[model samples]
Target chain A: MKSVLCILFTFGLWLLLTWSLDPKVVGVGLMMAILVATLLAHIYPDNPHKALDPRRWFWACIYFPYFLVLCIKSNLDVAYRVLHPDLPIRPGIVKIRTRLTSEMAKTFLANSITLTPGTMTVDIVGQDLYIHWINVHGVDAEEHTRRIVRPFEGLLRRVFE
Target chain B: MSETIAQWIIGVGLMFDLLGCLGLVRLPDVYNRLQAGTKCVTLGTCMIMFGTFLYGVAALDRPQMAVQALLCAVFVLLTSPVAAHAIARGAYRAGARLWEGSVIDRLGEDLHGVRPPAERAEPADQPAAVHHFTESES
Candidate 1:
């Protein structure tokens, strides 16, 4: 059932790209989508058989808008820092802790931090993530973690975990 | 009007890309440089691609071109952070020294086996063993 949905989604993407009423294009798209689903789907780390829930989808939808706002705000913030005469950056690597256990969730968290402007996940050791922050307001790890990691944690919990 | 909107979007993207480039030059070290290179460039490129997609869909009415732009944006979105991760890990492994202003060295404490090459001098307590550089060490 999951694989079928995956194939259908891929085929839908193909159709969207092609925008053709021709039956031949669809036949090719289906063939390609099936081939991809069969060959590559298992390579994805997450369980392909698990049913996707609408609740998760809802959280994801919420997450995207939040992320979009963060992206814009961060871009503007970084631009200001770049343009400032003092270049007001206090760069450092700070450690953070996360409750996320799955590799996919961890990757998502890392990618989110990297994209959000002032922070980048530099390394991960066990539950600890080393972040390279553009501005270091405080040396306390807990304080920095609260500032950096807490914002995205709840949404990610709902979405990935 | 659509053309003007596309131009403005593209203009914003160009400004971001330019700021990112300035960040690359102005930042102090490899990690700091990666911060600029990764975040700004990814956002800038994604915005540019998005603008191209908008232009195609709104102005040219070309679904295929818009899809192409979307695919580029998605591709950049997926790959950029992974690339940044790989580069950061490599730099840390290669013992790319941190900025003098850097507050902490967490990797130094966490990974006992991997030491910065400069700090790899044999300890006096351990009998000096002939060491061959592993692939990662080199």
Candidate 2:
């Protein structure tokens, strides 16, 4: 099942990248995708059936636009800080816990945090993520988790977990 | 009309790129610099690619160019954060210090085994740690 999913994914990527529908091109793409999937499918550890869930796809679609808006807002915030004279930064590394158990979900969470407002993930030790915040408003782990992780965690849980 | 819109978007993107470079110069330390540089540049470059896609589709009438440009934008979005995270991790592991005005250093504390007692107590439901042994130890 995983192999089939991998093959389909790889072939879909090939089609998108090539943007061609010619039979010869498609045949070659299918062959390559099969070969790659056979070699790489083992690395995909999650239940392959999860990838077929329509609800996850719906959330993922929602996530992209939501993330874009957040990205733009954060960029403007960063721009303000960059252009300001006093700099106004109170940077710090704080540890926050994540409810995400899977490695893939944790990775997505980390990447999202890095790209989001005023935070960059410095390290992930067990369930705790060490984040560098440009503006340190709080000290405690629960406070940091509430402010930093809460926003994305629900959405990510629906999509990945 | 589309050409003008694309030009404006590309212009704004260029301005963002400039600010990100300024950030690289102005920020205090490695972590701060990475934050500014990575976030700003990633968005800036992705916006530029988006502009290119619009230009290709409407101005040049080339769907292929538009698709490729959009793909580039997506690629940048997916990869930039990962790259930034790796750099941050590497810098920390390499002993790069945070800025003087920094308020905390949880990662450093964790690495040095100086975490507060409250944090040291693990929940009973938490999974057991995995240990790996080298040839000699084994």
Candidate 3:
């Protein structure tokens, strides 16, 4: 099942990249997709069936626009700091705990954190993620988690978990 | 009209790219630089790609070029953060010092068994070998 999913994904990518409907191009793409998918199927998530859920896809589609707004806001914030004469920054690495158990969800969470606001994920130690904040606001870990991780956690959980 | 819109979008993207480069120069440390460079540049490049897509489709009437541009934009969006995360992790493990203005060092504290220290105190710069605990435990 995982192999089948992988083949479909790879072949879709190949078609998109090639942007062709020619029979020869498709035939070669399928063969290559199968070969690659067979070699890489083991790395697929434990529950590949979750990918088929329409609800997950819906949330993912929603995530894009939401994420874009946040990304723009963050870019503006960074721009402000960069252009300021004082370079107003109080950088720090703070730890925040995540309730996400699945590796894929955790990865999405980490990537989202990196792109949003003034925070970047430096390292993930199990449930504890060390984030480098451009402006360290508060000392408490729970508060950091609330401010940094909570916004995306519920949405991501619905999408990946 | 479409060409004008695409040009404006691309122009905005160029401004963002310039700011990101400025950040690379102005930021005080490796981590902060990574933050600025990655976020601004990734968004900037994606916007440029998006403008190209619009111009190709609407202005030039080239579906192929538009599709390719859209694909490039998506590819950048997906991959840039992953690359930034890897670089940040590697820099930390390699013992890159945080800027003196940094207020906390939780990773250092976790590894060295110490609390957050005084503002100017530097963490002992041990080799990466000493920080194998993350890999071993996981």
Candidate 4:
């Protein structure tokens, strides 16, 4: 019941986001989301075959909105750089460590970083993460990761672990 | 009911977007700024987009633009936070610190092999280690 609700919630948000009142288009999108989500469920089915983490979903709902705001801000920042005379890109790669025990949270975090603009998740070494950034304030790994992650930890704590 | 109202909404939305950008520039560090950039700015842009959607309805029949703009918003919604998470994780892996100034890392107790309630039911942490990366250490 919970997993099914999760799928429905995901579908509803997606539909609202698309903002297409065109029933045909929305219906199609909803159907697609359901199909993929259901298939995913089967691939990791309930009980003995699969385990569902409602906490992760809860965290996902909480964390996702905040990330959206960051995206918009970053998008504008990048746009400014493009529009301005100086591109001001100070690209470099750095390494950092994590306290996240579950590989699931780590992987989600990795992929999240990649999706954001001007930053990339290069690799993961155990609990450590390797990132290529468009800029660096200093050479300290702990400081940098802390800045990047403070927004995420609470919701993530509720989520993928 | 009037163009003036639409104009006001649009202006407010733009201001929200602008304030977010300012936060991005002024915030102390990457992660802090990511908060300013991601949360405040995201709200600003969404508001701006929403105003435009309304304006389209009042001025022209460009509902398509509104819908498409909405779709763009959706894509951003699904992906942005995940991206931040990814970048944070990446930065952490790559040696970015939270702050030289902060004291508590709550994760310390949770991490020292103390499993979360979510993973405690089964003998969970049993995935085969992907590799022995000692050779890669310099």
Q: Each model's fnat?
A: 0.62, 0.77, 0.83, 0.04
User: A129, model 2: CA deviation in Å?
Assistant: 0.5
Q: Provide per-model DockQ scores.
A: 0.46, 0.56, 0.72, 0.06
Q: What is the C-alpha lDDT of each candidate?
A: 0.79, 0.86, 0.89, 0.56
lDDT of 2 by residue, A1-161 (tens): 88988998889888988999999999999999999998989887677677799999999999889888888888898899999987888888999999998877898999899988999998888999999999998768999999999989999999988
TM-score of chain A, every prediction, order shown = 0.81, 0.84, 0.90, 0.63
Candidate 1 lDDT at A106 equals: 88
- Candidate 4: tens digits of C-alpha lDDT, residues A43-144: 432342223666556667777777766665566655554344443555444566777766566766765565455555555668776555655656577787
Q: How would you encode candidate 4's per-residue C-alpha lDDT over B71-133 as one tens digit per residue?
A: 666665456656665565554444343332222222322334454433432334434432211
Which candidate wins on TM-score? 3
Proportion of native contacts present in model 4:
0.04
Question: Per-residue CA lDDT of candidate 2, range B50-80, in tens?
Answer: 9999999999999988988998898898899
- Candidate 4 regions exceeding 4 Å error are A1-38, A42-69, A102-104, A111-118, A158-161, B1-49, B52-72, B80-138
* A57: Cα error in model 1, Å: 1.3
Candidates sorted on TM-score, descending: 3, 2, 1, 4
Q: What value does the TM-score of chain B take for model 2?
A: 0.81
Docking quality class, candidate 1: acceptable
Clashes of each: 0, 0, 0, 38
